[model samples]
Each structure stands twice: as structure tokens, then as C-alpha cells.
Target: MCVSAALLLLAAVSRVTVAVTLPPHTYQTPYHAQVWSCREVLATLMEQELLGCSFTIISVHDDFSAALTPFLVALMITHSRPYQVVSVGGGDDVRPAWHSTSCDVYVIVAKRLLVLSDLLDTDDDSWDWQGRYLMFTSSSSANDLQRLAVTYKLQKTTDVLFFIRGTSDSELAVYTHKMYSKRSLKLLTLWRDGGFVKMVDLFPNKVNDLRGQQVRVLAVNHAPSVFSIIDHLGLLHNVSGLDVKVVQGLGRALNFTPVFHDPGADLWGSILPNGTATGMVGQVHTDDSEMGIGNVFLTEVRARYITFTVPFDFERACFITPAPRPLPTWMAVSFPFTLNVWILLVGSVLGLTVLVPVFGAGLMVRDYQELHSLSASFLLILAQFSNQSTRRPARTPMQVLVGFIMMCGFVVSVFYSSNLTAFMMVRAVEQPYTSIRQIVQSELQVGGYSDFWLAIFQGSANQDVRSLSQKFFRFDNVTKFLQSIISRQGVLLENTKHLEYLQKTFLTNRVGESSVRLMLEECINPFGVGVMLKRNSPLKSSADTMIQRMREAGLVDKFFKEVLQEARGPATQLSSNTDVGAEGINPLTLQHIQGVFLVLGGGMCAAMLVLVTEKAVAAGKYCL
Candidate 1:
């Protein structure tokens, strides 16, 4: 009895059915069952159902989750509604994760069809139930008449077209009258209990909606947008960029197949001395390719050469630089002012020494003998400037003047002390080249792909732009740029959109965000992003219309947001602590102020040497 119950449990768990042909041979009976992936079967049923429709797919197969790639590729090609696929089953409730796709077709698979209908659809008695669905069994339909009845009870009163296998023509005729479709597929493939081969054609290719229209597209193997998408359907195609979504969107709108061309090293087309176009733009200009689309910036110069559709994005051209390292802890002593300011303060002290003694000594010379002597007068003046007193001079006009000199000394002492405290209490944020002038003045070199920035800078009227043209070094390729950017070897000029995306995806993973920053104020020629095309290409208008529809439908923003969300692969968020201290003031240690002490030590040594030399000279004079 336990063994019999175990067989029933196994059949229930695997969504299979079993039956015994004869009571004596029951133990030897085979369980012939058929299974289908809901995604493929449903997509086939509603071939054009997903066209212009946003969709969601739910799969119960945990092992073969990648089966959704074909449907995802279709969405990419059509630029239809943004969609997602999720796995459900294994004792987990898969209810709350269900969100509406809005104008959607929900493709769901479970052990039975009723579970999906309850999750997705509202009952409509008038809806057609003819050939929209299929449920096939192997050679077990005959002896397992009770199992067939159980399946019917689960899928009762539904409009989904059914394809059921029957034992023979006599039994099939009986099954046909049961379902709304009255349709029954014979057990031809299972003739003499044969293996499953050439079992089904998901898409028979009977419909020819496209009549063979073709388009040539310019592409670079950029990631998360247009690169290479491979699927089990033997489809290995490129345009692996989310930016190239427009091409597919337009292709579907205009009914054409896109043929992509690679521009090799040059992404933006350049003008050779021979006056020929080369690069992605070049292909579009010469009609070698119909349109170029893949995160390419639209510029006035390119517009002059060829043509560009109205922009779908606003982007800027800016330079990327490595973030500055932390300032030395010992340097905090002189942090308030430059070395030149220290020199000027010392000179002021000397000037006041001479002037105060000379001006005040004459009037006091008559009253005090200490003031009458030049050396004594000098000492008295020095005491006032030093904010000290050897003897209180007479309260006379000249002495008053000396007192005033002492007050100036107090001001200097307070100023120096205050500045030193401020320096010791705070940190120096090492932001090198925050603005354009700063970048031009810094030793850090500016660089970018020559073909991209040179044209804009060369033709610009702004003096700053023209001056910047003189400073750029040409970048040869992406490999060198990636290495140099993190190491502080070079500052690269690139579009802010692509640069930001690259950081969120690639560079941040390797070098980290602590080492780099994009300078926006230093940006030049902020432009709109658009598809490149020939000067008088007829497809431009249609492409522009499709792009405008995406904008109107808010898909462009949603597409990029989805790309960023999906590509978030263990990227760490940049820490604010890297820039600012925990308490806002990073306390200075001896290391932070070491340079200040070093300069003072050198000054003391020089003074001691000079004093010793003067004493030696005096002793020599005494011997003479």
C-alpha cells in the first residue's frame, strides 16, 4: 500500500501521470508523460501577441532559467515594453513579486494551467478557447483514463485552446466532443512507442510579416547596450548596447532588418587629408551603412558632414582625472598660507624694528640715558616689537610711540597663532583642477580620442575652447585609457553619459572610486545624443518619429534606468568618508606639520653658525 502511494506522490510532484494496462502486469507498466516549457509554448501560441506589448514571464523551471533569452532578445529587437522574467516554485510563495506590466501579456508556467489562469486572467465567457493552447500526453492516455479526468477537472470551463492526445480514433472522437476546441492531435510521433524527435515546431515560419527589408547599421561592441547576445535558438547577434535600442525600435516600426558595421579603432568618423569620411559616421555619410547608433554624441560638426536625428539624450563632454591623494599630516603647520606669505611676514618684522627705534629714540634721548645710547635704544624698541619690556620707558611721546609698536607686535602674534590653530584643526581637501583654468594650469595632461574632440575645439569661437585645443593628447584606444585613468597618468575627455556608465560598470570594480572624479565645470560643448545618418537619408524621419514615441511613452528614461539597475554587479557605493573626515575636522599630527618643523630647524642651524662665526671674529680681533 505504501509503495502504491509513493508512485502516486512521485507522479504528482513531477506533473506526470501513470496507469497500469493489466492488473497482473501493473508493476512493469511504463509511465509515458509529456512536458512543455510554458514560455516557448505561450510565445508560439501568441506569436504577434508580444508585438508593441510590454510583458512579464514567470517560469517554474529552476534549472533552465536562461530560456527567457529569446523573448528578451525579441523585446530588444522590437524596442517594445520593458519586461522581466522571474523564477517561482520550490515551496516559496510567488505572489507578491507580481507587478503589472501595463499593456502586458503574462506568460506563466506551473504544474497545472488553472494556477496560472487564477494568477493572470479575468474570466470572459465570450473569449475563444479553440487553438490558443496545447496539452499533449505520451502513450499513457489509454490506460490512465482516470488521470485524464483529473486534468480535465483542473482545467475545467476555460477558453485556452487544448490539444489532447487520445488512444485511438475511436477514443479521440470521444475526447474531441469534451473540449471547447473539439481539437485532438493523434499520437503519430509516438508510433510504436518511438522516442521524441521532430516533436514540435514552435514557430512554423508560415507568417511573412517582413517581406525581406534590410538596413545597414553602424555598431561598436559597447557593453550593456550593443555587444553580443547569444541564445540557444542558435542566434548569436550583436548590437549588445541599450543605446542601440533605437535601431531595433525603428527597425520594427519601419519593418527592416539591421545589418551592423564595425568602425574598428575609430568610433567617431574622422576626416582624412584626402577628405573622405571614416568611422561610424563615415559609414552613415557614404551610405555604406544606413544609420549609426550606439552611445554616439551628436555634434554640429557631424551635422555639417552628414545628418543626425533629433536628440534623445542630453550629454556633456568633460575630462576625467584621478582624485588627489591625502595631504601630508606634517604639512598642517604651514597650511593656512603659502611659503611666500611667510617670507613677507618676516620682512615686515625687520622693517618695523628699524623704523620704531629710529623714530622714538631722539625724543627720549634727552630724558633717559638708556634711550640715548644707540644699542640701548635698539633694545628698547625691540622689547616693544616683541611684546615685552626690559624697563618701562618714561611715559613720554617717544615712549608712547614705542608702546604703539608693541601693540602691533601683539596683533602679529595673535594672527599667527589663530592661523596655526585653524590649520591644526582642519584638513586640506586635495581637489586638483576643479575648473577649466585650473586644468589648463595643472601639470596633469588632457587627452581624448583625437577624432572626437579635435573637431569641436578646432571649429569653436570661444577663446577658452580654442586655447584648450592646444593642450590635448590623442588617445589611441580604450585599454590605455583605462590603465591611465586610475593611475593618474592622464585626464581623458569623454562624454559624461558613457563615462558615468563605465564607472558604474567597469572601472570602479578594478581601481575603485576613491581614485577618480569627473569634472563637470571643465566640460566643453555639451550636446544632444542622436542616431547618425546620411545627409538626405529617407529613413531619418521615421527613425526620429520612433525615438520621439519612446520619449513620449517615457521608455528612454526607463530603459537606461533598467540597464543601470540590472548591471549593478557588486559595485560599491563611493564613501563620503574618503573625502570628509568623521567629525568634519581631521586633526593634524606631527606628520601633517613636518615640513614646517624642517624649515624652522634649518633656520636655527644657520643662525647658530652665523653667531659662532661673529664670536670667532671678535676673539681674533681681541688677540690682534
Candidate 2:
């Protein structure tokens, strides 16, 4: 008894004592437990395991006829976390419940009891031996028990048998097994030396289906999904947002403990050109993990090899491009009006200039004192168009014609004043690449993480996609890529989750504007992302069932609100073409009106040539 107490103290010192929540049970000093029957010793061991062991398992033989079978099962039922039970059968045939349950620890009520020699000859594969906390109720000799311990690699020091020599008649009579044919023999937790003593049989592990199985989960290191952060101690931990929360929520509901394996994003998952899987997908196929959880999109190519659970998030493939650059300085003047408007304005002025003189040229407005040449006439017309007074004959007809020209001049001046005021204020330009087509046409390069996206763009038949592929620049460094985009040097294609993550975590240190200024609305296509696993894995079905439950319960929506807090600040940036900016509208300047000036110069040169030709004809009149 002293030795047992000392050993337990040493074990606790060597290992951290896990605080396992246990069923209500009485605890005794070592002396009392050690001196009791073998059943008491076994019960004490199970209680210790249930209290401190990482996993606790107990098994019951599924034979209703056995005298001590019910007592042992009732005793085993008082267990908690890390504890599980399984039923074993005799050589005749397995029961429906026993076969389905895959019992781990069996308190054998064998029809034809096997000797120790037969147990030693038992195939190792017959039982999935994890070497967990094991205790069984069987009637066997001590020598056979030792041999059984050696064969199954179990502790021989602990007694696994119910029978004990020199114990009272109370142990052998088995009053708990007494049944009445006339009436029901009810038992109320009818057992001795500490175990379950309930009348009705209870299968806790069976009722709760999963039994807290430890599932090997692969959490791929993708931000906003399952981001891996290295602490000061140099240990990696998942600090992902909603996705990790979702996985944790599923784990609790499914009764599975996740042992995360992070090989990082580069080695996450991918379908090679040869149509096989690599990275986490290969790990699952090879049985290293049960499933890979992250933003694993269920594409057709990957679906061929990977089994996906019901999708949790469906998001579009979008781009994170640079801020808008300034407009060209040379186009400032003509930029306010369209080409057709400029042409129409020039034609109107020319038609009016020619008509003024042709319709009323010699109607007494012609006096030698006043200017009468075509050059003078053209200058006077410009003066009227610019709202400046010009010398003219004091003729009623000419006065009336000039008055009509003044009205046209007032409208032109008002149009110019309104258009140029915007540029005079805040001279900013519109963003050049508004759409995917515009981006492809621009000189800037486009790219992002080369997962499957680069291939998608390259293989596309659309001319815009083809052009984007031709000029694509793969991002070697995420920080540099983000900075480059903000500087208006390149455009990036990425998932919304990743883009949002980068915008919050990394872009604060960027040179210019933040998330709102950087446009990310151009989506190629929306793809379904879900929990991924090896093809035909049972875990897939379980995860799918639970994920749907979460969606229906509104748990998924709640998680998104808590985790994806990407709405840092309001964005005043406009996306549509007609949407005006806070900066100002593009204003027209001298460069815009060059079309008007060019025609005026051309007309003056033509007038001078005509006058010279007429003078030459008059000089040769003497010869005629």
C-alpha cells in the first residue's frame, strides 16, 4: 500500500496532472484501496485514469445471461472524458450492437472461455490496440492473467478480473444478478467495492456517438481562415478569424479534438498538371490527417481528387489594384467636352462669320471711314464672339446684326467659365482602370498568388484575360506587391479574405491611401470554398452534416460578424463612372480649345492668300 502511494506521487510529479471532470465518486486512502478485493483495485485504477489520464476507456461484454456481466457494466459506466467502452463477443457470433459499436475494452462473457494460450495466439489485427486505459472483467487464473498481460502489452500489476480468492461470500453469491420470472428484479446501482450501481443499463459512449475521438486536422496557414502566427517563443499558432472559429465550433459539436498540422500555405493543397494531388491533399490521401480546413475552394479539378464538405463560404475571385493616377496634362483643354461638341462649336462659328457678311455685306454699313477688308471683318467677328466691343459703322442694319452676335458670345463665355472652375480648384484625375477590360488595356502589370489563378487566366479565351495573362507579374513578396499597387504600378488578383486580411494587418504602413482608396470589386467568378479531406473519408460526411447545422442555426453568420471585422472605416471612393468624387470634376483649359484656335489661324491664312491672288489679277488687268 505504501509502495502504491509512493508510485502514484512520483507519476504525478513526472507528468502534469490533467484535470478531468469526473462523475461523483468516493476517494479513499491507499491502505483501504490496496487491501480490498481485486475489483476494488480495478475500480480505483479506473477512477484515477478518469480523473487525470488524457483518455479513459472501459469495455463491457454484451451477454445478458452472465451472472456478473451486468454488475461489471454498471461499474464501468461511471466514467468521463477520454473514457470509452466497447462490447466483445464469444466465438459463436457477434451481436448487432456489438458489431456496429467496435468495442475497445470488452468484459468478456465468452461462450467457450479461452485459455491464456489461446489469448496469446490471438491475432493482433483482430483488435485495434491503441494501448489506452484498459480494464476488463473476466474469470481467469493469475498465471493466465500475467500471460494475457504480456501478450497484449498491458500492465500485469493491475487486476482485470472480478473474482478474488479469500474474499467474502458476498462477492461470489452475486445478488445483483438475481432475477424474477414472475416480476422484474429491479437493481438500484447494485454493486460493491465502487463502480456504477444503476438499475437500468447506461451506455454513455454509445449514446454519444463520437466518443471524443481525436481527429488529426490540417489547418492550412491562410490569413482570415487559419493564419499561423509565430510567437516570441517561436511556436506557431492559428490566429485565423472566422474559419478557425468555425472549426472550433464544429469540433465541440462533433466531439472531436483537433490536433492541427500546419505545413503552411505554400504546401497547403494543389492539383498538379498531371491530375494528382499534392500538399495537404496528399497528406490526407496518405492518411497523415483526416481533413484540411481553410479557404479550400472546391474547384472541379480538385474535386476529382479531394472530397469537400458542404461549403461554408462562397466568394468571388477579385483583384486588389493600385490607387488612381493623375490624368494627362496635355489633354486638359479638350478633356471637358467630347470631340463631336468641339467640331460642332467650330462649324457654328465659321457659318455665322461667313453669313454675317454675305447676307448684309453692302447694305449701307459699308463706309470708307470704318474697316472694310476681310481681315477687319474677321477681327470684328472675333470681338463679337469674345463679348468685347469692336468699331463698326453707325448703321441700323449693322447694329442689329452685331446685337444678335453678342447673344451667342454670352452663352459661350458662360460655358467656358463653368467648365474651367473645377480645374482651377482641385486638379485631380479619374482612375484609368475602372474595369477588367480597362485594366488589361492599361500598361500596368497584373498578378497575385499563383495558386490556380494564373493558370485560369492563361487558359481563358477572352481577349482581356489573354492580355492580362501576357502582362501578368507574379508577386514574389506580399509587402512589396501591396506597396506597388498603392503606388499605381500594378494590379493584383486574390481572394476576398486574403485581400481584406492584408488591408487591415499590413496596409497601415503603406505610403498612401488605405483599403477604400484601393479598389477590389472586379471579380472573375465566385467559387465555393469548404472543408477538404481525402476522397471517401468518413470525416467528410460528419463535417458536412455539422456545417449545415451551423448555417441553419445562424452560428455561421454570427462568426462572420465577430471574425471578419474588415469594415475599419467608411469608403468615400466611388466605383461607377457617373459617380462624382469629392476632389473635383475634370476642368477644361487652353489645351482643350486648340481645335477652335487652329481653325481661326487657318481661316486667316486662307483669307490672306485669296486677297493676294485678287491683287495679282488686278495688276495684270493692263495686259488684258
Candidate 3:
């Protein structure tokens, strides 16, 4: 009887177990059964070409997203790329670090469509939506797909793919858009066909041609980079420069129209202390301008705000200051000989004056009475040195001494005359500051129109650059900065090419000589110059490709030379007399010989004073 009870209890337990397992087998949802297949479709999508090797999965805290995150991460790991899964409770809870970390592709899975939209539509620059994005949502309907398309279009997110899950897990709709266009979403294909997943090219060349669309460009009136000609009405008439030519070439190649806008007072913008950008950079940063062109340099700080194309040209930063003034004209008398030579000449004359009297006394020459007194000896020696003959001495020893003096005088006179003539013809100038170190050591205030130039060197590891940054000044008013340079009160820092252009165009005298001169030493090594575009601009790849082709074909350098030639016009010929010889020798003017007359007038005045003093003393003695 106990064995029979045990069998009945075992049968009851078996029936309960069968009832629990039968429901899962009979009412299983297609979604639960085909999750692995959905993963396979995702893996195929990820196999498409990407921008980099980093992968990111962004999802909200929901059952659908949480369940899918592991599968996406597994695929990324299997593909051997760096991967990160970011889980957020809501759109507003997204971390700031996620915005800065660059990823080649982002896989976003959300339970609700609103959550995905909220995450993408964050109204801040902290999150730069660069690279490819693929989105998946459990709320898949025709309207949901359309809403996703609109969201991407509104955000201008071009490199994106949308996966629309249908009622049956086997079917998924894939959609994307052509960049820089206002078209409806393009259907690449459904993910599954006849139980097999089909592969589609997620990212393609959509920006090859912009189809005559207007591209807004921010530009400044910086010469050789960009030149703007305005009419009397203050309207822009035309624009041309090396940078303009490049943009025009791009427009032609890519079939787009470039509409330029001036940043008004911003010019080439700078980053403020508050981390906001101004001018051309600000426009690009805020998406107000598609591109900024005016010899924009590629820097790490700037790269954070905007994207730069491949380098089209190179330039070195240089310091320009007023040209050194000519030395004082009154000092020309001493230009023929150095200080040591003048001292030696005076010493020789005095020595002859003393020795003549001493030698005459020692020789006991009866006919050498002129050399017996100091005054007589001095007059005789002075006459011989002046290349003038006086009464001859009858003594052989005195004649021999006079002949030697004449020979020495002739040699000295010839050298002095030649050097003096040269000095009179050419004006000597003061030594200029040739290097950054010299300018730093000088009292001249070093400055520029923009603080951007100063900021470039502020973080340098080089000691000299660090020292330069400490003394650097910034001027908001360009006119004032230029006036300071012209007035010789400050040194202006700028690019070498622009400085040269300024020297040729504006900073020149009426005679066509440059008023400002560039320092021999550069403030910084040559760096690359490129076009500035908003971060992750659609036109970057195409622009870079076209620029690379132009550089390789030597067209960039050709454009640079052509723009320079056009801006400079005819070469300036310094005014000169045709009577000058082939060696360019100039004749002496009154400006040169005034020093000699000054010395003569002073000597005559001294003589008159001495005569008056003698007469007065004689009168006083008579009275006494």
C-alpha cells in the first residue's frame, strides 16, 4: 500500500512540471526567439567602413536597451575595436565625458523613441556629433521611423543609419539620407530577406556634389589670404586672394555656390577667457557659417572648436617694427674714422710738435730757430700735416724730419678723403633689433592686434617663448596697433607672408621704401594654414580631397604667387638720378658737408674770443 502512494505522488509532480514548460513552447514570442538573429544583422552593419577604431554603445535605462547592450558590446569586442557602453537614466543624465570621447561609430538602443530624440537634441556644443551613428528602438512603426528621420535631419546628422523593428523579428527597415540635401529618408533595404540577412553600405560618399546649394563662408579683409573691395556705399564689390581661389576651386569641383559673410567687427575671431569664440571662429563654432577662410591656422585649441581641412599653405610668425632711422647728420665728421683712429691721429700730431722742439735743442742746429719755441714748433708740424708747405729748415736733420712728416701726412690724407667721400654719399643707419631676444631686451612695447598670437606662445616649453609671452600685449583696435608700429612705439607680431604684404601695400613711404621691417628671427617655426569649418562638417572630406589634389598638382603655390602679383601691381622703383654710375654712386649734398662748415665756424669763433681776451688783458695791464 505505501509503494502505490509513492507512485501517485510522483505522477502528480510530473504533471505540474509538464504544465509549467508547455506554455513557453506553445506561446513563445518571435522577438525572444530571434534576438540572436537581430544581433547578427547588427554585426553585419558594423562591418561597414568607419572613421576610426573606437566603438560606443549609448542606451537608456530600459528593459529593451539593457537587454540589447550586451549583444552590441560583444560584437564590438569580437571585431577587436575599443568599445564603451554608456547607460543613462534619461537624456539629461548624459555625462560630459561622453561628449569629448571620440568614437568612430555609436550604437544607440532605446526603449522609447522620445528618449533617443532627447539624447540627440541636446542644445549645447559640449557634445559634438561626429562619426557614424546607428539607432535601434523597440517602438518601431512607420510614424516612429519618420520621426527618427526628421530628428536626424533637424540635427544635420548625415552619417547615420536607422533600424526599424517590425512586428515580426525577422523584418527590419534600414534608412539613411544623402548629405547636404532636403530629401526624404532613403531606404537601403530591409535587414532580412528569405531567412538571410543582407549587407548594406551604411556610410557612402553623399557629399561628393552639393548640387548648387549655397555654402555660407565667413571671411575677413586680410590681404593675400582674403581681400575685400568695398564700394563708396560700403557694399562688397568683389573678393580675391589665395584663400578665395582655393574656395572657388572647391566650388567648381563640388558644384556649390559660396556666399561670403563678414564677421563685421570680429575679424579673425579669438577664444575669450570664458571659452566662447568670436569673429570668424565664432560663426563656424555656432554653425552660422559653413566655412571660415582668412589664412586660418590649425592649432590644438582651435581644433577643439572647429575642424580644419588639409594644410594648403604654410607660414611663419614674425615681428615687424619701424625701420631704424638714419644716424644724425651732424656726426658725419667722425664717420670716416673710428674713435681709436682719431685718438692715434691726435697723438701723432702732438708727439711731432713736442719732438721737433726737443730734437732741435738736442742737435744744437743754429738755423732751426723756428722749432726752438713750442708755439713755432706746433705751427710748423700742423702745416706739414695739412699737406701745405712752409719755410724750409736749412739743417739736414730738420729737413729729413720734415720729409718724413710729409710722407706720413700724404698717406693719412688719402685714406681720410676717400672714406669721407663715401660717408657723404651714403647715409648710415642705426642698428636695428634683429631677433626676438633683442626685442624682449629692448624697451619697445611688443604687441599685436589679437591676443591669439600671444596665446600661441603662452604654453610653450621653450624658455625664450615663455619670457616673450610675459611681456606681450594685445590691442583691440587695429588702427591703433598699426599706428604704434608706424610711430616706432611698438612691434607688431604677424605672419611673415602677411607682414611682407603689409610692407608692400600699406607700410611704405611715398618713395616706395618700406616703413616697417621684419625681424631676422621668426617668433615661431612655420605652421600649416588651412580652411576652418564647423566641427564634423559634411564638406570636410570632399574639401580635404580636393585640397590634397590641388596641393599635389602644385596649384596652391601657383595661386599664392598669382594673388601676390595681383595685389602688388607694378614693382616700385626707388627714385634715383640717371647721372649716377652703374655702381649706384650718389653725389654729396649740402646735407653731407654741413659738418665741415660747422667745425670751421667754431674754430674762427674760438680765435676771435682768444684775440678779444688778449686785448682786454693788455688794456687792464696798461690801466694798472
Predicted structure with the largest TM-score when compared to the true one: 3
Candidate 1 residue-wise lDDT at 32: 16
Off by over 4 Å in 2: 1-214, 230-235, 252-259, 273-276, 328-335, 362-409, 435-444, 458-463, 466-474, 486-489, 503-522, 536-542, 545-624
Clash numbers, per candidate? 18, 10, 0
The C-alpha TM-scores of every prediction are 0.50, 0.53, 0.68
Error at 69, model 1, angstroms: 55
1 or 2, greater by TM-score: 2
Candidate 3 per-residue lDDT, tens place, 308-328, comes to 999898888888887888888
lDDT scores in order: 0.54, 0.53, 0.71
Q: Which is better, 2 or 3, measured by TM-score?
A: 3
Residue 46 lDDT (model 2): 54
Q: Give per-residue lDDT, candidate 1, residue 434.
A: 73
Worst 10 residues of 2 by lDDT: 1-10
Residue 399 in model 2: lDDT: 74
Which 10-residue window in model 1 sums to the lowest lDDT? 1-10
Q: Give the winner by lDDT.
A: 3
TM-score quality measure for candidate 1: 0.50
Model 3 lDDT-worst window of ten: 1-10
